[model samples]
Target chain A: MPDSEGHPDFDELELGAVLTALADPIRRQVVAVLAGEPDGTERPCSSFGLPLTKSTLTYHFRLLRESGLVRQVNRGNSRMAQLRRADLEARFPGLLALVVAETQQAGKGAPSVAGNTARAPH
Target chain B: MPDSEGHPDFDELELGAVLTALADPIRRQVVAVLAGEPDGTERPCSSFGLPLTKSTLTYHFRLLRESGLVRQVNRGNSRMAQLRRADLEARFPGLLALVVAETQQAGKGAPSVAGNTARAPH
Candidate 1:
């Protein structure tokens, strides 16, 4: 993806940076929205419905793409994001599962998890 | 555990911060050590033998404890850290599992964080 400053942004981030970028709920929502999205396809920056402003949204997307979590290609005047599922999962196996599960659990379910305790590996 | 400055450091960290703190391999290793570790117990910061300086080691432990990934208690002059497994598991279910899986993948296996290609979720 072509970074606005005429440089490559998505290739520069390390695994930790990408994971850190994805840790936020807002960012996770962006990733979930992206992962469920198609490859070589792009989603508009504004279509995701974030709580922050456009600039902040830009920052988040930039971070994601930078960390190799998402790849952004310029579409006309807007930026479209596609998640690096294969790239990241290869780099960190079961990571995508972890992200998807956590994001889904955090968003779709709200059961206080009061009774869910560790069952020790048998 | 009590925060060195009076406040509870572990309690103050949010879910994202906790995840962020654990994103690093060193931190994750620490968590693995603490998790496989028993509760109501503590491990000295030096026992793990991180490559960073003592101050940096202190900093990482502080960050881990602050993030609720680990709990620290003053054990003489050395602080013993424990993973708040139950508390964290309650706060974010399946999270400890995710951490364990990722850390193990990153450490025990030195397979380059390479791409395994995506298998469409059919």
Candidate 2:
């Protein structure tokens, strides 16, 4: 049985972290795929098909998991990921809807480039 | 007349930039205040009461403007800021709502700290 040992609790999920994690195009693409799946569906790490190296993909998955956006569990020799849809909806309602909507929009030929590169103000 | 010269067009507003801009707590607070105000209500930059230095605040405002989350225009001696609610709603539905909701939730005594500091995967 997979235990939720490393996942942040629902209350521990911060808005900034969630937003930051979802800000990446690749992470958002991963989230979009997860959002399309049925509830409680667990996908192997290799199932994402992201155009990146294995190490880069691993990093993205770790960020998503740490941000409380997705839950990852070790299954046999591979890692499985699942979007914490219910937890996210309970904490930040309508957030996933926007991600899914944006993904759909991008899929309809909208460019997914980050046009604005405003530096973070310290 | 306030011309939208520096602001990105609705189509040019990228999800990553918008999310990156909103990921900062200070910027999100500014957006939350604007969301609470009436439609088309423009407030001077000094009205936000943020703890950041003047330069830092200005940077945040500029980032928000560049990201298409807020519009800043010079009104006489002061720079006034307004939430581009309509534009955001049209571009990414439920996005501003999530910001507003998160703000409200934070205001309800939740700690608004960015607990998850997972580095951005490049």
Candidate 3:
């Protein structure tokens, strides 16, 4: 597993890449979950319970990390992911909030691919 | 050129599609330019001066219009485009502002494909 060293520096975060990484419904749901967590809290990738294969989840996490939206670190045997909230807020103010808001709205209104129902216990 | 009838309504604007449309640097540049204009101001598609073929520019504008980010209307032989500021603000507050701010920052910094230099007089 690659380490946080691969994460883009705050100054290196590009708006286009970040937005592109976040354009997916699943990715936005993952981001919304991380955004809802208490500050500094890190959760393992499995904790998301997204309706995706393990490899697909891994791909999503890698995209998130490379886009500077999330930071991933090896936690024992699990890979823990944390939103780079402060960095994102500083780099693209109000962007994260909108993601969270939109995700929540989607979760409430429709049965989207990334909606809460999609995360039902397996 | 299709009329605004093909445009997505405010309620039909999906976050994923909107973000996907905005993910491109060229599209972001167009949004930034429209955002900077006075409220209700509309500009013809050719006015953007983007470095792209006519067909490619049409594709970008279509994506923008279909995503509900920009509204386009047939003005004689030319199509005029305007940012759907009010609808976007009502649907995803702060998102457009972030787009504008990031584009401005990119414009001032390194020369990017969507930077101000790319819009230099042809």
Could you give candidate 3's per-residue lDDT for residues B1-122 as a string of tens digits? Answer: 44766699989988889999988888988898899889888998888877688999999998999999999988888889988999999988888888888767766765456432235454
Retained true contacts (fraction), each candidate: 0.33, 0.72, 0.78
Task: Order the candidate numbers by DockQ, best to worst.
Answer: 3, 2, 1
Question: Which candidate tops lDDT?
Answer: 3
| Candidate 1: clashing pairs of residues | A91-B113
Error in Å for residue A20 of model 2: 0.8
Q: Sorted on TM-score, highest at the top, how do the candidates line up?
A: 3, 2, 1
Instruction: Give the CA lDDT, 0 to 100, for residue A74 in model 3.
Output: 75
- Candidate 2: residue A22 Cα off by (Å): 0.5
TM for every model, in the order presented, reads 0.59, 0.83, 0.86
Q: What is the lDDT of residue B77 in candidate 3?
A: 89
Residue B70, model 3: Cα distance from true site in angstroms: 0.9
List, residue by residue over B1-122, the lDDT tens digit for candidate 1.
Answer: 43454224434545566667777778877776566545645667777756689999988877776666776666566666667777776665665665565556556655233222222222
lDDT of 2 by residue, B38-87 (tens): 98999987887765578987888889999998888888898889999999
TM-score of 3: 0.86
DockQ of predicted candidate 2: 0.51
lDDT of 2 by residue, A1-122 (tens): 44676689889988888998888888988888788777877776677656788998888888999889999977666677889999999888878888887777768764343222222223
Model 1 lDDT per residue over A55-92, tens place: 98888887776667777777788777777777766555
